[model samples]
Target chain A: MAHITVTVDGTSYKGEVEPRKLLVHWLREDIGRVGTVVGCDTSNCGACTVLLNGRSVKSCSVLAVQADGSEVTTIQGLSDGNEWHPVQTAFKECHGLQCGYCTPGMVMATVDLLSENPTPSEQEIREGLEGNLCRCTGYHNIVKSVSYAADLMSAGPTKGAK
Target chain B: MIPVEFDYVKVTTIDQAIAALKAGGEDSKIISGGQSLVPVLRLRMAEPSVLVDCGAIDEMLGVREDGGSITIGAATTHHAVMSNPLVQKHALLLAQATATVADPAIRHRGTTGGALAHADPAGDVPAAALALDASFTIAGPGGRRTVAAKDFFLDYFTTAVGPDEILVSFSIPKCDWGSHYAKFNRTAQAWAIVGVAAVVNVEGGVIKEARIGLTNMAPTAVRASTVEAALVGASSAADITAAAMHAADGTRATSDLHAKADYREHLARVITARAVRAASGI
Candidate 1:
């Protein structure tokens, strides 16, 4: 076991992690933050997306030991623990997901995307979410969800929580 | 899948990193950014005893200019390369090609030196570097030595570098010639099945010079010598197109799950023509 200190979503947690513990596994298994799901152990499926020090990365590709001393924000960290994040709200409002297996990662990717590009074209949205794959919902509604999230965050009061 | 048990040590300086690599010797590997090495480790494609993390080395994480060539630290991320004003204004081929790797997230962490060191023939940066005639500065126990880009890549996934040597920086010359990079792939974020990087100097309606580099059509990123030879004095669109068609002649393209060799050869010509036209400003 190796000692590591990671700041996730705002709080600091220190623990002894295995050298092989992936960041996604640490978030979902050890910390019990199941909101960050793991789909494919491989990096292809972006089901374990998270914000690492502000930029979005596949949590599955990030090692927990490598993530030491970094700030990570997952789907569970989006809101103030009371209401849904703007992107999450948009995802729910626009009916973005079907099976919901890839929703958390998609929502996180959307959150990072809208933050970087406040106003994105339809093609930009498509390219932005290319890393996150969704088998269901056909991505038509998911694109709408990202656009709606952009509008809500850019024009509404839920901006400070991100 | 969890990687097999291995001891990980994060080294801070180049000397320390090199020392660690030598300590572990054949059983160790240097990981900078982990964009490529991490995936390989996860797939069990490579397993080493010690991972010398070069990501934290401050000396290997910057971009600067010495005299004529712009020197980039080995650990500088692709995002940094794309955003750097020096690289954008001078080595735009490097910047442009770096942006097309995987996606924005991967770019944020992937390093230019790592990609070339990893030596994936289908990757965009290596071919661009080859077209621009970049030189690599490698550091080892003996001292520092510079290797030209053409001589650096030996084969598919093989470089001229020895085990004890570490690639410290790449020096790219500022070519005033027009350049363009084009990759033909199946999806928005996939490896290039076939691609071309063209650097041309169009002087008074005459093709004064042209350097054409091909990707995914051979064992390594290669120069289209036949096409380049045919293009020296030809300026007309038709002549250039005809010359560009020979980009894949006398070559062997490895057919994989992505596309067939003939299809890659076909796409090579197509992308080469587009690259030539774009670079020619026609």
Candidate 2:
């Protein structure tokens, strides 16, 4: 077992993890960050996507030990108190999800995407979220949510809908 | 899908990585970004006894100018490589191909060296590296050695890198040639059904020099020398299309779920023509 210190959302957690432990499993089973769900255990589905050191990555494809000393931001840490993040607000406003199984990953991926490209085109948003998969096939509104989130973010933090 | 338990060793230097690999024995595997390796581990395809994490190795983490060539650290992520100005200016084919790998999230965590060392025939970067004439720098107990891109990929999921050796970086020669990677895939994140990496130097509407690399055409990425030779002095799309007909001359394409060997061969011809036309601006 290897001891690792990782900061999730804003809380730092220290644990002894087996070398084989995936970051997604550690986040869900060990620390109770179940917001990051595992869809396809394989890396194809980005249901376990999270921010690793401010960049998006599939947590299932990263070892817990590899994430040692790194900061991870999951879907659980997106809002501040009662106020939702612009991405979260946009998803709700635009009805980005149906079954909601892929919402967390979709929202987190949008945050990362908008961070890089503040104002992406429709094609760019489609290409940006290619890693994520929604079995419900609700991509039309998801793309709408991303574009709306871009608008919300660009309008300033104060403009987020309650 | 939890992987089998194994010992993990994180190293910050190439020498330390070499020592850890030596201590871990032949079953040990070196992991950088863990994009490919972790997936294999979860699938239980590879059960290494020890995993030497080279992600923190300082020497293997950035792109630098090395005279006429640019040296990209083995651990440099695909995102970094694609956006790197040096790589864009020197080896645009690599940047173009790296941009198409997996997706934004995968690119964030996947490293160029990791993809090259993993040596998946369906991967996009190996063919780009071959087209760019990139050379891999590997470090072992006996010291360091450089292997050309043409000779680096030995077989499917295999490389010239030995068990005790760590792939340090890749040195790619600078070239001011038009390049394009024509990739055909069924889905957004799926592996290339067939990919053609083309780099051509055109002068006065005539091809002066050209290099072509085929992906998923064989057990490893191979150069389309016949097509390359046929494309020289050609001034039109017809010439390029005719030249691309020989793309499957020496390729060992295989039948798979995505495409039959013959279909892949046909793709090789069609995609090679498109890539060459775009690369040469015909």
**Candidate 1, A126: how far from true, in Å?**
1.4
RMSD (CA, angstroms), candidate 1: 1.9
Q: Model 1, residue B264: what's the lDDT?
A: 85
**Residue A59 in candidate 1, Cα distance off native in Å:** 1.4
Worst 10 residues of 1 chain B by lDDT: B101-110
Looking at model 2, residue B224 earns an lDDT score of: 98
Backbone clash numbers for all candidates listed: 0, 0
Q: Candidate 2 lDDT, tens digit per residue, B79-142?
A: 9999999999999999999999999999999999999999999999999999999999999999
Best by DockQ: 2
Write candidate 2's Cα lDDT for A20-66 as tens digits: 99999999999999999999989988999999999999999999989
Q: What interface RMSD does every candidate have? A: 1.4, 0.6
| Cα-based lDDT at residue A19, candidate 2 | 87
DockQ of each: 0.60, 0.94
**Chain B TM-score, all predictions listed:** 0.97, 0.99
Q: What TM-score, over all chains together, does every model reach?
A: 0.95, 0.99
Please, what are the lDDT tens digits per residue for candidate 1 over residues A1-162? 889999988989998887767898999887888999989877766888899998888888777888889999998898876767888888888899999999988988887888789999999999888878888887999999999888888787755342
